[model samples]
Target: MQCTDHTVSLDTWKNIQSLGIQCKRTTYRGVRAGWRKQVKKHTNASPPGNVSLNPPSPSVNLGVINAQSVGSKSAILVDSILDHKFDLVAITETWLKPDDSTADFTPDGYTFTHIPRVSKRGGGHVTEPTHYLGRMLDLVISREGESILAHTKVKERFSDHFVLACKLNMNRPPTLKKIITTRHLKAINITDFCSDFCSSAFSTNLSEITDMSHLVDQYNKSLTDIFNMHAPAKTRTVIIRPFSPWYNDEIREAKHKRRQLEKKWRRSKLEIDRQLYSEQRHFVIGLMCNAKINFYSALINESANDQKQMFKTFDKLLHRSKDSPLPKSSSDEALANRFSDYFIKKIKTIRDLFPPTVTSTCIDVSTNICLDHFTLTTEDEVRKIIMNSPSKSCSLDPVPTWIVKEGIDIFLPALTHLINTSLQSGSVPAVLKEAHVRPLLKKSGLDQDDLKNYRPVSNLPWISKLIERVVSARISDFQERNQLQECYQSAYKKRHSVETALLRVQSDILSALNSGDICALIF
Candidate 1:
């Protein structure tokens, strides 16, 4: 409990339990002498020292041991760790080298960072002038009473000097092992490695392949192999229905009892059993309500660190989306097919307004646009266009834009040739037309039950986008040269605007008036 101005009287303290309040009596300490939201009358700032709400611990036991050679006396070091259990241990004169393997000497759950001797460097010093007193960064923010306990001692030792060991019981790291399953293509960022590998892979593997399909297949496979070798895929856990705070033994039992009672009621033809079942159902509902109340109340009274947990719980309660199960399908493939069929139908319906007959109207061609008269796309242009494409998920080709961009320089020659071939052929590749679609919820409520409430977002490959851009540029150039489109159309044409149209109309109207001729409609 916190009181701003008034002191807590005897009655106030006694009735505190009824008010459902928790408190810590310690006064907050800050640089401004004491904690103040806004200091009205300024006072001198307090010196930075041990002026804190949390008292410093005097039981910290940190020690150091220099055993001269750790490889010979590793057993002794383990015994020392077990006996003393020191908070921190620092040892000097570790005679370890860069090429030395430490795989066998790794601790069970502890992490270690080491500094190798200075004799192995080819370049005088890579980063800093100082010696290798190796360290990590300010990754995690330390809270009150928080500390890191490092157990650096390993059984299979190799150094002459004893390894530095640190231990802390209060602030141990998390032990939960999270499994992650990913292709690792998205995670790895080795542009040089990718470029070199791709350059060699595509050149050697794709040199003799005559079939275009076979060439692309081998090229993709080689790239995939190189990537897999460098940065392998990961097997991770994906949580579908994660654990909930409100669900517990009491709630579980209550739910089970309700289910049992429901079954009994359905089975019995007598009115007495039905009446008893109704009573049980009401009792179970009350039990669930109480459990929920207790759960939220406990969360509300928790420390500030658990605010996120509380918010997640609140969100879970608000939505209750997990309770509503999806419709049953034969398999995952069946479900995908079902959704594809439904959305395709919807799309066809939407597109039916303009029939084939309407679309086949004759196009006026006063000036001939020579079908083969096209400028060959340059290497730089192709590179720029591909790079300009957004880094999105891969399509049927499974070629990510980022990966393509990373090794763009190496693959530019091949890409330029491909684009040239496409232009000369006057046909886009079938792969470019292929797309992957994902269905997303449009919005919540009012129309949630209908198929129309969902929208499909189609993701196309970078190759498709590149082709479209090329074709669009040529079309626009042709349109401008032939004056095919109306000059008054300000929407798509270059250097045209609403103001330009208005000015042209004004000029026509003034000319009509001066010539004593009627302008029926100036526009």
Candidate 2:
């Protein structure tokens, strides 16, 4: 017996049947396949009309196609797969080069591998009428005994080939879930919050508090209570998705409107509704593009003068969002304790490096002036300092600095008394010295899990900052009056900064140049 063009004569077919052999033919367009197999007959089998040879099981849907040159049609291909709910897919004649990345063609939920023609161009194998001309060049093959429930030929064309969809016996894995915590600060009413704060026991006896440490504890507890009462924390389960930092209210509203229009079009099945929905979709896309551009432009402009900030902006624009995850530990408390131990050990080591005792040599005093004590601060002085200070606050603050500034009249009398009592005692309150310390990464590209790569950032309470300002002002006044500060010292001095230092150096250099004197500079 001989086969020609996937066909055989009638006599040859009969001879094969008599020999207990089965033959089947599959054809699509000009493509043809002929199969020959040896059949095993069982005598105890059930009736053909009532029984089945194989039982069905849970399955995974798969698809195959020939994308001649899947350049810009990646989105279209992904959409089709999603619509058909294919769990896995294979492609032929992807026409991707070695330089082309598989990630560029792969969708979010799927991954792909590409074996391109390396030696020469257009040498890769192509498949399923995968050709403009009806031809089954692409194939979807399964292993022996592997059940395929359906083999469908999709009419939609992705390239030259038609989509071949198959359902096999496998199960798809379930998606992962993530949980996050969120605070609803927007739900709080500023007016009601202020009223509640004023009525709270925070200022029941402002001048009666003789101990500064007790006053600070009361301040922290009262503020935290008020904040929690207004905006309680909540936990929620959420799916992790790609974050768009530029997404804002306008774009969100536009997207919502577009979805409404899309639902209307789908329900009505009207051409006008479809057109309206399409317009809204385009509008939403434009809005997003504009918002992204504006957001990035503002970032660039704001960081133009700061080199470090500019590089950070560039990293965001290039999608280099590398956030190091927290290191593994037994528990959050354990991690905190580890960090505390590390920092404490480091500080102790540095302190130990200095000599325990120093030889002292007496020198003749050049000036008789001295600053023995800080003058008492009045309510007016305290109010001025608080008003001039930046509206920055930390979690440790009883209330935000801005809130204190807004109601300065209500808080000034007590705050002034607290400052005067501490000044008279010549000792800072223990509570004021306390700070909330956060571990911040030293710089980019460092090993975040290492304790040495982190630095402690201490955030002091608002009231502590106010007292510091008052003390700084008094010290500055004393230094200026006595001329105790070095004339050349340009740091931490009023009207003196890096720019002023640079100006002084430049002027000296010019003077030396004019006088024909050599000027040596060291950095």
Candidate 3:
């Protein structure tokens, strides 16, 4: 035997050798007309007397056939293989070319390696009738005589070609199988939780604690205790399967119906049953396609205003996996310490760039622009701020933002006093300053295990954010009155954004063109 055009892979060669076949590389002469006769002579020859046809041991069943063309006959081929319980299969005369993929013809739980006759259109030998026709054009050969048992011709015809099933006295080698913790927030009753919070000492005795640190600590502890009582955390081992964003209940039911119909068709083998199964299969396919379309359309519509969310939606659609896990060499504590050291060193390096002290003398200005102290917050102002803020919370928060908003009226007085106390003392409580810092990947397509590829995202306590908002509002008001803010700065200003900045640039360019002045922009 000679192989010319395509080379068999080392793994495939090893598999062939394991079956007791000896292969050697040889130059291929052009196909001769007598090559078929020569192959037939060799295939029909008897094995040596020393070789045993059947060994008293467990063995593997293998099948071979001439597919002629496997493209449209893959389904039939798969069914025949399953019915025969063939451990492996070798196909011939597949009529495949270099450009064709074997994956399209390969069955599930099986893989294929093809060495197409690339040099010519068709050139193979013939055998005894294993086909509907009187002659068999397909051949199955084994190097070791004992490896090829008597070929039993299958009664079923696969695309006008018959299968040669054989049992080999060779043993097949044996092949070698995230817990998440989440709180049951859905089980919590908002009404009962609010009533319980209102009755708690943290609410009623807020005025008794004058110390800011003690007040903050008690606030955290009380809210956590109440929240945990209502919705406790649970841990379970969950199977991580491929995420199908569009797979919902409706599609699941359709798929279940399709499977039932398929089973019925296979069992009954009736025309009506087959037709019903086919129709159901098509229906399920259509349902899945429509569901996927609707899912993406809705996602696009909802994320129209949010570019970050829009990008995330694109990632979902593209089926991009999350960042790789952190390196396993370091323990959790060690990783945290390393991150802290890196950030600290980075801060110190930046600080080192500046002088230790400034020698410039202070100059007094005559303008009456001053923001020495922040005014104490009123209950109304505090309520407005809480209501207007986005309902987002950090894990560090004693309660979720939605829960706080839900019980705002009950929480108003104490929250109002806390804000006023902070403003009066011109200091934030230590507990409120604490944040849950999570290291997030800076962007996609980066080495996630590297510390440099991540940035720390700090989620501060809700009350701390509220106080910061109050201070920001006061500073903004002072800036507006004194015109201390830069005129060209569009970010972090009300009703101002990247769009506004772009519009300003466009207007300036247009004005420059109208005035016959050349405008050069620099990044």
Question: Which candidate leads in TM-score?
Answer: 3
User: How well is each residue in 232-305 modelled by candidate 2, as lDDT tens digits?
Assistant: 76789975433456667887687678668755544443444445666776676567667767989999999999
Give the lDDT of residue 201 in candidate 3.
90
What is the C-alpha lDDT profile of model 3 across 24-97, one tens digit per residue? 33424432323333434434444543224343357677777777777656444554566576777777667766
TM-score of 1: 0.42
Error of 1 at 110 (Å): 34
- Model 3 residue runs over 4 Å out of place are 1-177, 301-311, 321-325, 359-364, 446-450
Taking all chains together, each candidate's TM-score versus the true structure is 0.42, 0.61, 0.65
Q: Which 10 consecutive residues of model 3 have the lowest summed lDDT?
A: 30-39
Q: Pairing residues by index, what is the TM-score of model 2? A: 0.61
lDDT of each: 0.51, 0.66, 0.69
Global Cα lDDT for candidate 1: 0.51
Evaluated at residue 254, the lDDT of candidate 3 is 73
Worst 10 residues of 1 by lDDT: 123-132
How well is each residue in 34-126 modelled by candidate 1, as lDDT tens digits? 211111111112222212323234433333444443444333343344334444334333344566533222222323355655774211111
After superposition, which runs of candidate 1 have C-alpha atoms over 4 Å from their true positions? Answer: 1-180, 183-192, 195-201, 205-215, 239-332, 347-365, 395-399, 443-446, 486-523
